[model samples]
Target: MAERYGVVPTRRQRLPLVLGVLVSLVLLAWLLWAAWSHSTPAVAGGLTSYDVVSSHQVRVVVDVSRQDGDPVTCTVSAQAEDHVVVGEDDVTFPAGPARTVQTTMTLRTEREATSVAVTDCRAGSGGPGARAPGR
Candidate 1:
């Protein structure tokens, strides 16, 4: 018989190679899903309105929602006309009957605040204290 001219994969070798490719594809898919999921925010909410009660105080209202009914934490901030952060506070919401709740927070500022908003929000598992942006 003529000798084989090319490298032909044997059955044993082919089995391992096919399995390796399948495993690699599965791992790649998992990694892609994890990256996509983490890149998006899990919490949903926004600032409803803000009122400057006084030169040193601001009342901010936010509507927060989590489908899982889990508690959430929010950062309320007040900014002066110059776009400087005058006041900031971390407010925690305990688990309640409603998944969506409107929260009112009061922030004390060093000077008058021209605008206020809810800057960031996350799940309650973030623990106590404030969350700096990008955390």
Candidate 2:
């Protein structure tokens, strides 16, 4: 191996290093701004009410919000005592206003659901429908 002491890199070598750092900085800045601008309150509130309709079913109510009148889709999940997912459903929110909305969703479980909650909510153009297992 050849060893050199107190060697300084030439301008040609340093140019690519400096340019790479500058490019990385610009990319990071753009990502930050894009995230900040597109970010919106996904879940406005938690489960408003949860009713155990039966041993294999649950009725859950949640409050969701968005920035426009576009419809929103939410994933409602039910968990058992062991925190295992027993059931899940995707319910759509109709377009109305850019404000908080109270949505009721029904989930059918294979066993029993000890707790239910809205996992995710997002705004988009879609119609109201139910996506549940064995439906």
- lDDT score for residue 79 of model 2: 93
lDDT of 2 at 59: 83
Error of 2 at 80 (Å): 1.3
Worst-scoring 10-residue span by lDDT in model 1? 126-135
Query: For residue 107, what is the lDDT in candidate 2?
Result: 81
Cα-lDDT of candidate 1: 0.80
lDDT of each: 0.80, 0.75
lDDT of candidate 1 over 1-135, digit per residue (tens): 237576777899899889999999999999999999877766777888888999999877788887676778887888999999999887776666687878677778999999887788888745557533223
TM-score of every model? Answer: 0.69, 0.68
User: Which parts of model 1 have CA positions greater than 4 angstroms off?
Assistant: 1-7, 10-20, 39-42, 125-135
CA-only RMSD, every prediction: 5.4, 6.1
The local lDDT score (0 to 100) that residue 66 gets in candidate 2 is 68
